[model samples]
Target: MYQFPKGFLWGAATSAPQSEGAALKDGKSPTTWDKWFEMEPELFYDQVGPENTSNTYELYKEDVANMKAMNLNSFRTSIAWSRLLPDGKNLNPKAVAFYRDYFQELVDNGVEPIINLFHFDMPWWLMEKGGWEARESVDHFAYYASVAFEQFGDIVKKWATFNEPLVHIECGYYGDAHWPKVHDFKRAIQVGYHTLLAHAKAVAAFRESKYNDGQISIILNLSPVYPRSQEPADLEAAKWADHIYIRSFLDCAVKGDFADEFVALLKEADLAPVTEAGDREIFLNNTVDFVGCNYYQPMRVQAPEVAKRPISDPHDLFAPYDWPEKRINPHRGWEIYPRGIYDIAMRLKESYDNIPWYISENGMGVSEEERFENLDGIIEDDYRIEFIEDHLAELHRAIEAGSPCFGYHLWTFADCWSWLNAYKNRYGYYRVDIKDGFKRTPKQSSFWMADVIAKNGFSREQI
Candidate 1:
């Protein structure tokens, strides 16, 4: 057994919208997700939208019990921002009661709940008011953060300010996948800067709050960006990719500054982040205590002779140019290189002083329907099992070589919802009968995880 350090945190991760259902039952206003799901349900795969998800909102007590059944020591779940404030200010008693009770229930179950403030679900009213692209949205976000921490901080100790700020930029704004879809590189830059400003402000507020037993952090989707080859152009492309993907937020949060080269790129491209005079100083000054890492796969980058402009959907009225480069990942049609995890850790250790980090979100998403069958409902998810084990092995090696990672929280505790993917990409240890009122049935990997948590290590390489 490769013994992990004492008091290592081993649990599963979930976002509120992804796991918690009752998306709009309890006095909750329509977030952008609710609006989108209502307006164009067909936009999602299989026509499965984000209306009523895993029923976690209604079944949280039972869900907590299920976590205990799975031998979880700590659980990661984000708080729905709209749920808390409804309209980011109007107090919703029902939402408060639901979350209060849910968090308390988890605590009673001996499972420490790590609460994140925002998880990709933006309040629709904010969208009408310009969403994340406007300066006011940042203030609104900071206000939401304060409200959440003030209310839940007593019960929830670990608070994630935002779940993957860059993702909300790339997928939501720049890519075609997410809400308020736009492909404006200039807006993307401004939006990223504003989001970081909000994060730093929230972290500062959290430190000032009465909650003393906990810490506040931001979870970023960090990938190990690799050059496609030994060519210098490819290496430069990788560096550019890294700056946009990780360093932009990382340096802002940790060093209280943005990279000069990064700023230069924005200026040279005329896509520099729009910010208030002191925003940079504010973000660089206030730092987080930990990092919530959402590791999916590595990125292979190569310079494009001519990168295309950002692609826009019907929703966005304006657009700008995108990076002049290319990226590829074959496994799963996305990247599947596990060494990215090691590279991320090594970079963090070497550059950022190895600030305390946890793998807040990491797991493999597979089509779960055809995989699980009549073997007493056991999903021989050897593929998923291998994915996690491989990442953990790399993490272990990094730790041995001096990476200050404290814990690992898989992408999910159970299959819930992916903003646009619906139920197509299942990342869960337990399979929920999507039709049977979302009844959760533990997969074969569930027991495997429990044993790993119970013993803190496996007896051998392959269980």
Candidate 2:
């Protein structure tokens, strides 16, 4: 049996925008997701918008109960910026009350709450002010972070400044997957610079505030990149891909500054972000207390087919290489490589001074899970159980090798609404019925998770 260390956290994670339904309720303002749905409803799956979600806003008490039932010792969820400060400047009384009650409920139920400040759900007002593009947005975000710490400092001990800030930089600016979709490389780099600066400012705020005792982190989706061949060109492509995708944010967060090589590349390509004085000092001083690594899959890459001397986009330096022997989750259109978890852990150990961290998010999202339901209205999601076991086995190997991994959290607790994808893919221990009053039902994996958490370990025979 592969056993976890004592007091290791076991739980799930979900963002406020993805789970909390009452979008405009309780004096809350509209977010980018809400505005996007209004402008382009067809972009979401089944035409479902942000308003039609799991209704956690009203049913969080029950949600906490479900989490406790599954033996989850911890839970990670974000606080919607728009909800707390509808105008992005002033606090809303109702929103503050609601969050206090919700977070307190998690603690009351013996579930440690790891609260994230931002998860790409910028208020519509912020977007109107150019969102992350405008340098002033960094100051606004720092004020917001101070407000969160001062308000919830007593209830929550662990905090995250941002979740997957790269997706906001890549999908929202460089691609068209998220809100304010545009295809501008210059704007993307500036947005990334502002985002990281905002993170540092928030960390500085936390350190200066009365809640300086609390731990702060940033959750990054770090995927280990693999080369398609042993050729030097392919190897170089993989290194560049890692620099662009993972190290850009990882190094800044952990080391408090960008790598010299990355800076030189950006300057050579004329893609460097405009920065002001004192920014370097802020980054150099304010580093995270720990890190949250969210690993889902590995990235396979090769040298770009048509390499440009001065790269215009990240794709110009590296190209995706499809592997012949790869298992894929056809439902989500993602490659499933459980070993990536170990690779990520070891990379953090060897490359980042063995910083303390945890698996903040990891899970399988399968579509049409109803097809696996048995007669008793229980979904026989044996595939989900096997997925967790396979990933945990690899995680155990890393832990045995002295990786400072303290916990593992699945992608979500209940199958909450996913942006763009909507409810098309179900990734929860308890099945959420969106059709019938958003009822919650435990799948087979819920029981399996309970058993694993109870023992704090499992073997292949348990499967």
Candidate 3:
């Protein structure tokens, strides 16, 4: 039996825009995502936008009931900044009332609500003012965070300042997967620095607030970097990849400073972000109480091929290589390396002092949903069940080796709108039928997960 500790948090996570439908209702303003969808509908799958998602805004109570039915002891959801503070300054009373009622409903259903301040839904007005690239935007976010803490701190014992900050930096700034898609390395670095600053400022605000007893953290999607070969060049390539992708934010959040070598390399390349006076102290003084890590896959790096012409794109510096022999999830196009979770846990334990981390997001997203339907009219997702089991077995191994992991939250509770991909890929225990009046149907994996949560673990026979 792979038994987890007693009271280990068993829950699922969902973001506001991904699940909540009411985009412009109750004094809500448009986020950058809302504006992006309007500007380029074709960028989304089948032109599906976030205007009408799973209707969680109006059906949160029913969702909480579903959570309770699944035996979930905790649920992680983000507060829509556009909903709470439409202008990014004033609080919307209607939105405030809605969140109070919604969070209370989760608590009423015996599910601990884990609140996150930002989940890639920046206010359009704030984006117009340059978003995270501008230092002033950091102050704006800190003010918004302070309001959230003052308002919801009593009910919510766990708060995350930002969910996947590097995702916004990489996708929105470096890649084109998210809103405000800009492809500039310098801008990406500036935005990343400002984001880390905003997190630190929020941590400082939370510490000074009257409701400072609760734990606060930042959720990072930490993927370990691995060399594709034992060659020195491949190992060096992997080191660079880890420095740029993992240590860039992890060091700043945990150690309260950027790695000197990393900073020096960026400076040498004229890509270092501009730092203001006293910003160093802000980060140094307010390290997170804990860290929320979301592991999906390991990164395979190899030495770059020499080219006659100069390489201009900064993304090519790390030289990310795909191993043809690596195990892969055909549907989602992600590498399937369950051992990466244990590697990440060990890294946290040895490097970050094992400061009470948890798996905030881990799950399988698959295509071809129709093929999974069974004779009982449910999604018999045995693949997803096996995926979770394998990952949990690795996680159990890490915990047994003295990793301070207290919880595990799957990527989502239900199939909802994903950014860019929209509803093309579904990653949920409960499947939501978008065409059928947004119906929620529990998949086979949901029942399996319910049993796992009830037993506090799983045995080989159960699998």
Candidate 4:
């Protein structure tokens, strides 16, 4: 039998724009997502936009009831910055009342709320002011974080400054997946640097405020890098890949600065971003209280076929190699390597002083929902159950080996809406039917997860 520690947190996570509809209601302003959808509706799957999602703004009470029914003791969700500050400088009274009631409901249902400040939904006004690329945006973000602490600090004790900062840097500044897409490597570095600075400033503010004895951290999507073979060139490639993708943020968040080797490489390439006088001191003074890691898969890297050129784009530094023998998720086309999670946990234990971490987001997203529906009007989702079980077993091994992991939150609670994928891939314990007034029905995995929560762990015999 597998047994986790007492009071271990078991729950699910969701972002605001993906689940909460009513984009313009209750004095809410438009975010980058709202503007992006308006500009290019066809970019989204099925042409579904953020204007009408799961209507969580109107149905949060029902959603909290569903969380309690699932035996979840903790729930992680983000407050929309656009909803709270319509003008990006002033707080809306109606939005404050809404969150106060929403957070209180979770507490009333005996569910602990883990509040995150930013989750990729930047207010439109902030984007107009040059977004994260501009250094002043960092100060604005810190001020916004202070306002959130003062407003909701009494009820919420656990806070994450940003959810997946790397995702924003890579997708928005380097790739075309997110809004304000700019494909300049130098700009990407600048944006990433400012984001880390904002996180540190907010952490320093949190410590000074002493609000509810809270802990502040940043959630990172940390995937271990592996060399394609034992060759020295391939191994060297993996090191650079780790520096560019993982360590760029990990070192700053944990060690309070970038690695010297990486800094030298950046200097060599003439790709260093602009840094002010006291920024290093700020990062050094305000380290994270804990770390939130979101692991989904491992990255495989190999030596480039030819000599590398000067920095043209963010991905030009290293190349990703797909191993033919790796197991792939048929529905999502993503590599499924459960051992990667264990590697991440152990590495944290050994490398970064283990500083207390948790799996903030990990789950499977499958397309073609009708194939999984059963005659009982429920999604069988046995594949998803197996997927989660295999990962959890590895996590259990990590815990037994003394990794300071105290919680595991799945990618989401309900299959609401994706950014560009829309509802093409669903990753929720409860299936949401947008056609039927956004009705939610529990999938088989929901009941199975409820059992796992009740038992605190699962046995191989049970599976």
Candidate 5:
């Protein structure tokens, strides 16, 4: 058995909106997600509306109890922006009191709290005003972050400014998949830049706050970038994909500069991310204390003859309607190349000084046939166990190679709510019966994770 260092973090993650159903209560304003559910209910699977979620707002005690049962020594969850500041400006007293109590429960249970500020939840008020694309939203976001830190910083010390910023930029701005469904690359690029700026500003704000043990970070969903072959053109395309997809924000946030090659690429394409006065310095100087990486899969790229294209540019080189090249896992339809985790880890170690870091998320999604067949008990999750073990094995390699790795936290503890999938693509350890008043039950993989965390390593031969 491979042993993890003492005091490693072992737990699961969830967010307020995904788990807490009382969406319209707690003085919460409509988030962009809430609005999405209402405006285009068809976009959601089965048109599952968002009125009632996991109800964590009313069930923190039971959730915490679930954590204890999981043998979790640590837990990660995001605070809903609209919940605390209903209109995205003023603080609601009950909201603050509720979260304070929620966080305190974790502390009381010896569960280390890793609090993320934003997890793809945007206040509808902000979106109505053009969301992150407009400069005003940046300032408004800074204010909202400051408010969150001011109100909750006392109990929640470990904080993340944003979760998977690129996904938001890609899904929200450049693609019509996520909310605000605006498909403008220029807006996407600008919003991407501003998101980084917002992260830096939030980090600065958190530093200024008087929270004990306060640490600020940004969570990136990093996939290992791969070239299909050693051909020169293929390698070039691979590097380009890696730069725009992974390195851009990471270099700026962790290493204090945009990658020179990516910057040159941007310049050559006449697509340098527009920067405001002092934005570069804010990013350069306000490096995050840690990196929270959400590793899922890797990108396998082959050079295509799309010449007028800026590879990795949000602008579609392929027709806007066509999907790009990547191996899709037939089982779940996600690109399931496992080496991405290793490559992502090594990239961070090689380029970003290997800052203290943790794996914030890594999980697999499966069709709901198992659920319909009444086959989703904790014991039947071997595929998930295998998926996690594969990534962790790579992480073990990175750690041995001297990456400043801390620990790992799976995407969720028990079956919690996903944003668009509603209760469909359940990524939880303890499965929550969505119809049973959000009742919780452990999947077999959850118990496997407990053993994995307890033992720290699994081998290929073991399979």
Candidate 6:
């Protein structure tokens, strides 16, 4: 049996924008998601919008009860900036009260709440001010972080500054998948830089707050970059991709600066974001106490095909190379590379001084899960169990190989709504029936997960 270390945090995660359904209620301002849905309802799957999420805003107590029942010792979720500060400045009394009671409930149930400050649900007012592209957004974010720490920092010991911040840069700025949809690489770089600066400022705030010893992190959705071949160009392309996507934020948050090669690349392309003289000091002085790694897929790339490259575009440095033998989750169209977890841990150990980290988010999303419901009215999600087990096996290998991994958290706790995708892909041990009052019901995997938590290890024979 492969045993997890003592006090391993067995947990699950969900974001406020994805799980909480009250979009524009109780003095809450509209987020970019709510406004986007209002502008283009057709863009979302089944025309579902942020207002129709898991209704956790109203059903949070039940959610906590479910977590306790599932043997979850910890839960990671984000506080909606719009909810906490409706106008992005003043605190909302009702919102503060709601979060306090909710977090207290989690603690009362023995589930430590790992709260994050941002999860891409930018308040529309902030987006109107150019969002992360504006330097002022960094100050506003720092203020918001300070307020959060002052309010609930005592109850929520573990805090994250941002969740998958690269997604905001890539999807919102470089692609049209998210809010403020624009296809400008220069804008993406600025947004990414500003976001990192905000994270550093938040870390600084956490240090000054009374809960200085409490853990603070930035949850990065990291992907291992693979080359198409062992050729010099392919290897160089892969390394460049890694620097841009993974190391850019990883190094800044963990090691306190961007790689020299990455900075050179930015300067050569004339794509560097504007920065103040003291920004470097802010980053260096406010490095995070830990890291939260969200691994789902790997990036396979080769050198760009054309001889000439566009100076404005970052993608000009590399070209995507789809692996023919890659196993994929057909439901979500993501590569199922379990070994990437081990690879990521080893890289962190060797390259980044082995910072204490956790599998902040890792789970399989399946479509039409109700089709697998058995006669007992429970979804027989043995496939989800198998997916988690495979990943956990690789995590065990990483732990044994001297990786400083302390915990593992699945992507979600309940079948919550995804932005744009809505409820298309369900990733929860407890199936939340959206049609039937958002009822929560445990699937087969929940029982299996409970047993794993109880034992702290599992053998293949159990399966």
Candidate 3 lDDT over 1-463, as tens digits, reads 9999988999989899999989998899999889999999998899999998888987788788999999999999999988988988789999889899999999988899999999999899989989998889999999998999999888988999999998999998878998778988789989999999999999999998889989999999899999988888788778878888899889988989988877877877777888989999999999988888888888888887851112344445557788898888899999999999999999999999888998999988998676889887799999889999999999999999999899999988988899888888889988888898888889998999999999999997776
> How well does candidate 4 match the true structure, expressed as C-alpha RMSD?
1.2
For TM-score, candidate 3 versus 6, the one ahead is: 6
- Candidate 5 residue lDDT tens string, 1-463: 5556678787777777778778888578888888888888888877776677777777789989878766788888888888888887688998889888989999998888999888888889888888887778777778878888888888887888898899989898878778878777667778888888888888887777777367888888877667767888767767777777888878877877787866776677676666778877787778899998887776667676664555444322212112266545455678766677667777777777778888898877765725433443443766777777777777777777887778788888867767677766767787777777777777777677766665665556554
Model 5, position 331: C-alpha lDDT score = 54
lDDT per model, in order? 0.78, 0.93, 0.89, 0.89, 0.77, 0.92
Of 2 and 5, the candidate ranking higher by TM-score = 2
Best by lDDT: 2
**Against the true structure, candidate 5 has what lDDT?**
0.77
What's the TM-score of every candidate structure? 0.93, 0.99, 0.97, 0.98, 0.92, 0.99
| Model 6 segments more than 4 A misplaced | 307-310
Pairs clashing within candidate 5: 20-56, 21-53, 21-55, 378-443, 378-444, 379-444, 413-429, 414-428, 414-430
lDDT of 2 by residue, 103-203 (tens): 99999999999999999899999899999999999999999999999999899899999999999889999788898989999899999999999999999
lDDT at 264, model 2: 91
What global local distance difference test value does model 2 have? 0.93
- Regions of candidate 2 where Cα sits further than 4 Å from its true position: none
Candidate 1, superposed: residue stretches over 4 Å from native: 307-331
Residue by residue across 103-192, what tens digits does model 4's lDDT show? 999999988999999999988898998899999988988888888999999999999999999998889987899988888888888898
- Each prediction's Cα RMSD? 4.1, 0.8, 1.5, 1.2, 3.0, 1.0
Rank by lDDT, descending? 2, 6, 3, 4, 1, 5
> Model 6 over residues 30-115: C-alpha lDDT tens digits?
99999999999999999999996999999999999999988999999999999999998899998999999999999999999999
How far residue 24's Cα lies from its native spot in candidate 2, in Å, is: 0.7
Model 6 local distance difference test score: 0.92
Pairs that clash in candidate 2? none
